[model samples]
Target: MAAIVARENLTYKRWDFPNCAGRIVNMDEDLRAVGERIRSLMPGELSQRSLAERAGMKPDALSRALNGQRGFSSQELAHIADVIGADLHWLVTGAVDPRRVRIAARHAWDSDRGVRVNPGRAHDEELLGHVVHAYNAAFPDGPPPSAPLSDDPADMGATLGGSFVRKFGSVVESRLGVDVIRLPMLSTDYSLTIGSRAIILLATTPNWFRSNWSLAHELAHLALGHHGGDQAPGEAEELPADEFAAHLLLPEELVRQHDWQAMGEQGLARFLWETGVSTIAAKNRLAKLNIRYSTEVAVALKQSTPVAVRADAGDERGTFERRRAIILRQQESSTRAMPPILAEALQRRVEDGAVSPEDLAWVLDVSVDEIDFPEPDDSAAMAQAYRQAFENRPSHADLEAWLAANGKPAR
Candidate 1:
């Protein structure tokens, strides 16, 4: 078989579903089943063409088969399954089962052990299911059915995170003790424990609502049974369960009820009051929902929040993780520091066990300066680029496009 090849010297590999881990009856029929499974985990409104593009195939050809106008070859079917992070065997036979396939997919990201697993991870569809399943098992039927929000969205995020730690810590403490922290680090995210202790490190940044959402997502990773054992961080890297954390934290039902699809920046910001999610998280989630007005609606969703200009108890953690630093230093001898913003973003990714700081810094063309941990401040800083823009500030689209061109998240 001529295997599909990636152009960018991709450092990614796929793990075959374990035939022995579970009963394997048939595979061809299972392939269709797996395709449906992958589609379920994806956002609605995505084009078959785009999905095919991700799989490195011609869309017209894929669409024809998907629409049942033609038959898909076995290799084409397997490639589609792989691109969407589906188990080929499960998709073909329905014999491998979701749990076994999910576990097999999770193992693809493993690299050595210990802190080595912390960085160099990618998050995609496969990890998303693992995270969700793990959370469902850990919490059973969703979160502890809390009453709707009675406070501001920002306040709700903080209060909920604090409340969860206080209330659920006892239950989780047996398996994973809660570390209520205000890390000197720049990022506003927390982490799940590794190896034996299974300690869950919960941190908060200035945006209370986003911070709270992150905490919930981290908790979900633990409850979902995805973060423990010898499982390396790589398995969860593709779609850093954090994305799902935000979604599960803010249920789709509540979001749809608000008709957030029609809301503009101000309206969406106002809508956050009822949903209890921050503007940033809400926007990202909105993008993933694949609603009717998504294309046009994405215009409004692309709006940016002023970087939380503060340094306080739940803020001031500069971006960059301990593990990322080790990796970046080892990878780039000439580099020594990172810009404040990029550093923080990479840090959050690391805490979420997504990407390592060193790789992020290298990718972003920044070097890590002295390891200075500052207290969380409440003031947001305007970078030179912003200052130069004067009244007509650069749009989020401009930044995102730039980041895409530069191969990094918008600064």
Candidate 2:
């Protein structure tokens, strides 16, 4: 068989096998390149045999493919890509799809001994994919400005004010241009980055402090550029994110300014209330800074609840109610079925006929009937409008004659 090797678009190597049924084949070089890419994507602890088992391929077959003795079918490649959380297009073509959105989250993957596995990753990727698509379609110019509000966590925490817990999400959204969505069904928080823009999905819970920490943690992932399954032994990525969240939520400078070691449970409660961080988070932050509290104070702080903390902090009934109202409002804003910016964009797309109401409803995770779509103009009205606009324009012959009559000479 005569084989003619060629390169297309500098993407992949192709082999034209004219003598054998005229079917083109990928060159061995391309196959080896793809194998190398897949190897690079796999975690250090994940063996080829283990990956093959997870991807439902025979060990020998995978080994052969990896050695460039054979090529993987499209289905096989897709299965392997899913197993490793890789982009199949990138694996095959060695080119990243600019429109592709990558989601990263802690505790999404786990390694049991030497075996790598994904535990309870949930529907984060699928849901975030829909959001990203809707958002991109709605705003082709890309998401709002994504500049960092401040590089220093202490400045960020201080600038957000004492109500930073309630204001953090909005600040992240408006200042960082990160779309923050709070979903009651999500098991954990997720960060989805598309180019420079990012979307953070916060899992809603009654504990607003924990929710705030989760949001800040996800923002940390974005800032550190950690994508899903990119890090082996997930803890490597988690520690930094947690540290970032701690600093952002409870600035070290603020913590050091107060004598926390001597401040009993009441003062600890005050700190929690003021910083909007959970008891454990505050404790960890102190431990990280080597600020030790008495054993009695530690026990009291740990045993305290939000209600008890509020009361101990000397909040009056009216003040408590006001703060409670703010928390409720913040939760409501964060837990919207769809993010406001995304919802607006989707609505605009629907109005402009770029997207369907059914699609919008599906993306919003609501029934189509529940959505209020604008009344579309009648076809006759649209036709009339087009006809009027067309009638107002000069004809091609008239424009040519006018140009000939008043044409300017070249300088």
Candidate 3:
């Protein structure tokens, strides 16, 4: 069957789902369901003809898609939704109103004082206004909850990452009404700021300090109207964002007094644990103080904070272990809800015979399967499965030559 293909990089892949291991998002499965929705709306004798005419497809092609005999192409589904007066988003997710998703496809820019832009990014003044408006609406008041404004930004662990995480990821959620994910991993300089829906995703799970820093970094991109556009961002924009996040996360006065050399390794480690400041970030602050990393100091620091130990003689679990336990529990107990649009779309695919019952069952969360059926005669699927199989297929002609060389006649 024909499949709905997503534009590369535009859609998230399946692995992006809340599994901590997942890294991206995609929308192919969701579009497949749109075909079902189209078919569902087009019932009766003349329905196929009506849909075909509206979508600019031949009646036979539409019939095949509706009957699950073939898949609708991406172009066909998009056009069909338009003809049916369905929002493209509705076909994709059944969640968004058409009016809400419609926006001019112009680059965001402003020229009050004539400034070069990062292209398609916040180049258009009007688009910037909408984003700013959304941001303002979410942050009508001052900044959402954050680590308490400290007198000592340079105090090793003086800041709480949990507080900052709660601010952008939680308190901000109350305002932006979009996804704000916080992941735990060692990868650095990683984040996704989807300007379209005000979505901000942060993946910095390995070190809470760095995760918190990345959150501020991504937030800076969103708030400063840096969309990164289609091109790799030049330092012209990135430096400013980095500066914004640094100022936001590390106040000037406190950073000014951070005695990097004097604090030494143990001091730095304790400060990091307390403030959620990663060593890399600490290095930068230290660089200003002319403080460099020392192996002896590092050893002292590592010895300072073992896996899990009692901060106080009364605590049962080590601080690290406690945090670990909480994370593990959260992972095990928390289930990310499937977007209603995706759920509906996949369900439609099943109903229209485009997808198999087993496939549906595997994708679903619960034991939703009741009755099972024989596997489908997915000839299209099979052909697609083997589309490139012959790329390295053994050559029959070559095989015959080899046999002749061995004094064996070809059969």
lDDT string for model 2 (117-203, tens) is 335465555665666777777777666545554545666665656666757787777656778877665667778766456778877
How well does candidate 2 score on lDDT at residue 322?
A: 49
The RMSD (Cα, Å) of candidate 1 is 26.1
Residue runs of model 2 more than 4 Å from their true location after superposition: 1-98, 108-118, 123-126, 140-145, 148-163, 228-233, 304-308, 313-334, 362-367, 370-411
Model 1, 289-368: lDDT tens per residue? 86554443355445443222111112234323423432432233222222233235445554554443444444244563
- Summarize candidate 3's per-residue lDDT along 255-331 as a digit string, tens digits: 55655445555455445554444555555555654555556445454442322112222244555665674364334
Stretches off by above 4 angstroms in model 1 are: 1-177, 186-190, 194-198, 202-204, 235-240, 261-264, 273-280, 293-300, 306-411
- Give the range of the ten consecutive residues with the poorest summed lDDT in model 1: 306-315
How high a TM-score does candidate 1 get? 0.31
- Top model number, TM-score: 2
Clashes by residue pair, model 2: none
Models 1 onward score TM values of: 0.31, 0.62, 0.36
Alpha-carbon lDDT, every model:
0.42, 0.70, 0.47
Better of 1 and 3 by lDDT: 3
